[model samples]
Target: MPHLTIVANIKANADKVDLVKSELLKLIDPTVAEPGCVQYDLHQDNDDPAHFLFYENWESRELWQMHSNSNHVKALAAATEDAIEELSIYEMTKVH
Candidate 1:
């Protein structure tokens, strides 16, 4: 089976960029240590500090789902509830 790839785009509220970023940063360490996690990387747009993106690879969609429902992820959601302007997540498999 093909590995799962996740592309998450996050846009922070104008005044909450720093808070959102810090909360997002908290996910990396724990997520990387989760089962089936192959890669977990986070990035901020060079021209737009309020924009952030996450590139992730998982061994399977099921395992990724587990990670998604973990406590840490939930905390992130709660912490940034009102601080985020937009959030988009795309689940895909590599074609090449």
Candidate 2:
């Protein structure tokens, strides 16, 4: 199976930036330790503090799908339902 890359762009409510960050940060350790997870790093926009990004590389599409529906991920989704302003997921494969 080919490697998969995921770029997740998340925007936090301006007034809930801190709360959002705390919630997202909680997933890092577990996500990184999951099987097939090559890299899972989180980033905050330099100019726009409320904007966040997740750079993740997985071994395959199946593994990524599993990760997406994992307990922790589901918990995060429920926990931050109202705190998130925008959530976009991009799944890609390298061409070159």
Candidate 3:
């Protein structure tokens, strides 16, 4: 089966950009160390600092789901509650 790819975009409230960024940064190391994580990368939009994106690849959708439900992910939700403006997630399979 093809690997699962996730594209997550996070938009933070103007006043909370730094806070949201810090919380998002906390996910990298832990996520990269997870069982099925193939790649996990985070990026910030140079033109819009409040916008952040995560590009991730997992061995399978099930493993990615497990990672989403992990304690660290929950913590991120809690820590950034009310600080985010919008969140979008896309799950995909590589075509090539």
State each model's CA lDDT, in order.
0.97, 0.94, 0.97
Instruction: Give the residue spans of candidate 3 off by over 4 A.
Output: none
Per-residue accuracy of model 1 over 25-88 as CA lDDT, tens digit each: 9999999999999999999999999999999999999999999999999999999999999999
Off by over 4 Å in 2: none
Whole-model lDDT for model 3 versus the true structure?
0.97
Residue-level lDDT of model 3, residues 1-96, one tens digit each, is 899999999999999999999999999999999999999999999999999999999999999999999999999999999999999999998998
lDDT of 2 by residue, 1-90 (tens): 568999999999999899889999999998999999999999999999999999999999989999999999999999898999999999
Model 1's TM-score against the true structure: 0.98
Total residue pair clashes for candidate 2: 0
